[model samples]
Each structure stands twice: as structure tokens, then as C-alpha cells.
Target: ELFYPKNKQHWREWLFNNHHRKDAVWLVFYKKQSDRKTISWSDAVDEALCFGWIDSKVESIDKESYKQYFCQRKPNSTWSKINKEKIEKLISTNQMTKAGFKAVERAKQNGSWTILDQVEALILPEDLKQALAGYKNALEYFDGLSKSNKKMLLYWIISAKRQETRQKRINELAELAGKGQKPKQFR
Candidate 1:
């Protein structure tokens, strides 16, 4: 469902009433310059975290506003570094609801809470680095990529459980990067 929350409190009320039942919500937020006042994205995220929800894809609705999708955190959802910090703050501030604490506990029990944290500083694997070295353009392109893009590529490659799968991904990445393209998943 789409929601236009006027402010942080409005969003909090909506989540309080519907967080347990709604599968997802598309929240509309006004741009800073928009005449219509709305909750800022940062505040919205903090509020969602309080309810054990997470935000994902954002799409522009118009010049004035955009919509972001928020949903209940899945059992296997991996927590991001920023979200982990946010969770800590929320906990310290006593803003986290029971549902939010439950979600954090589930992640801790399943070991997803610290998985991303351990790899927060994504390192380029030697094998992938060697492969990219063979393609100068690929190396240059990979080097110039934004941190998030590089992290996504590295995570996708490293997350492969099998050695052969990881090697295949490295080769594919080199080939794609040589062509000045990112992985299809990222694109």
C-alpha cells in the first residue's frame, strides 16, 4: 500500500497500527524543496527500524516527491552496517519495540547480524584482481566504480559457497567490467 505520511510521528502511528499486518508499504516523501511537508527519508528509516521494518528500492513519483518501499525484515535478511548502527542507537534510546527486538534477536540467532559487519571493508580478492589485471579497461572501470557498486560486486562474488563458482563469477566480472558494464544484478 502507498502512504503519504506528513511527518515522522504520522509514519510512526501508521507503523504502530499496521506493521504486524502489512506485508509492505510504499511511502511517499516530498523533496526538500517541495511545498508539501513530509517526513525526511532518514527519519522514516529510523521509524521503520523501530518497527522491525526495512526500506528498499526508491522511485521518483515526480519532481516534488519519491516513494520508497518498506517491508518487514525477513528471517534471513542480512543487516547492513548503517542499519546495525541505527539499531544500536534505537536500542540505546529505548525506541525499539518488541517486534524490532525480536527481529534483531532472530538475526543474531541466525548469524546474519554480524556477517556483513565482518566484511564491512570489502577487499578485492587476489584472484579477481589478477583477472581484472589482464583486462586494463576492466581494472580501470572497477577501480573507478562507486563504493556501493564495488561492494555489491565483491559481495556477489565472495558469497558463492563453492570455489569454482567464485572463479566463474570473477571471470564474468572481468569480462563485464572490460565492456564497461556492471553485473546484471547491479544494473
Candidate 2:
């Protein structure tokens, strides 16, 4: 794992040092608030993703105003439209490091970075809602899903590689949910 500096001021220097590294590594950072003086997960994630890095599982060090952050560039990680937009902004602001630049270029060549998909969980777009609406039983069941169960459905729907595939999943989930079934693994 790699560790970025604690402040935004240290980003450039730290990035330069790790710019040439070929493999992904974690960068640790901290955020503090006026009230608690702590950094946020979103901030760390946004910054790390800009440099082609991803935020890994987190751990608590103590009850202090700080926590350890695990940040790394995942070569095979999928890109989300939201994160893709953030990376573009980082580039325009001259915040992207060379390794990050190469990663983006590679994604471009591979057609993974640019192709936007509904790759998030727990967000039900109108299309999916309409699809599920056709089945009243499923709709009722879907409405009764717990947050985690709903999120599983969302992840499945969003990760569908094809339109037909997603439709099929929606149907299946609806049928299962109609029977008051929670996502099997989730339940």
C-alpha cells in the first residue's frame, strides 16, 4: 500500500514519487472537520480514483480523529460513470499522475473506461422501475425489500451486460420477491 500526504498540499510531491511505480498501491490520507477534524471517505475515494486508485476495505486505528485509508490502483476494476467524470475533472485540473494517465489510456483502448453503464447498486432508474412495474406481485415484493435486499437487486440490475439480460434479471427478481423472497445470499 502507498500513503499520500495528509493535506492537499502534499498530493503533488507524493504523486511524483509514486508516479513510476507499475503496480497499484494504497495511499493513506486523513480528513478533519472543524467539529471533529476528520477526513471523509468520499474525499479519499474521489482523490484516489482520480489517480487510478481504488479505496479498499477500511479499518479503525483508534478513537482518535483519524483513520487509516487503503488506496490503490486496481488494474482490473470496473469504472463507473460518476467516477469516470471525476477522473476527467482531475485531468483538466492537472491533478492526474502519469500512472493514472496510462491507466486511463489503457481503459480507453480496451473500451472499458469510456463506455458508461448503470454500474451502481441501490439506485433504481426509471427504466428498471417501469420494467418491474409490469409485475404487480413483484412490485409489491420489491417494495417490501430491506435496504440490503434492495441494494442487491440494484447491483444485479446495474451490472447487467445487456438490455435483455437486465430484463431477465428484473423478471426473476420480481418473481422471487413476489414470493416474499429476499435475495438468497443476502437473506
Best by lDDT: 1
* Candidate 1 lDDT by residue in tens digits, 1-187: 7999999999999999999999899999988888998998889999999999999999999998999999999988889889999999999999999989999999999987876763578678889989998886999999898988888888888678799999999999999899999878789
Backbone clashes in candidate 1 total 0
lDDT of 2: 0.61
Per-candidate TM-score against the hidden true structure: 0.78, 0.62
For candidate 2, give the lDDT of residue 166: 77
Q: Rate the local accuracy (lDDT) of all candidates.
A: 0.90, 0.61
| RMSD values, in order shown | 3.6, 5.2
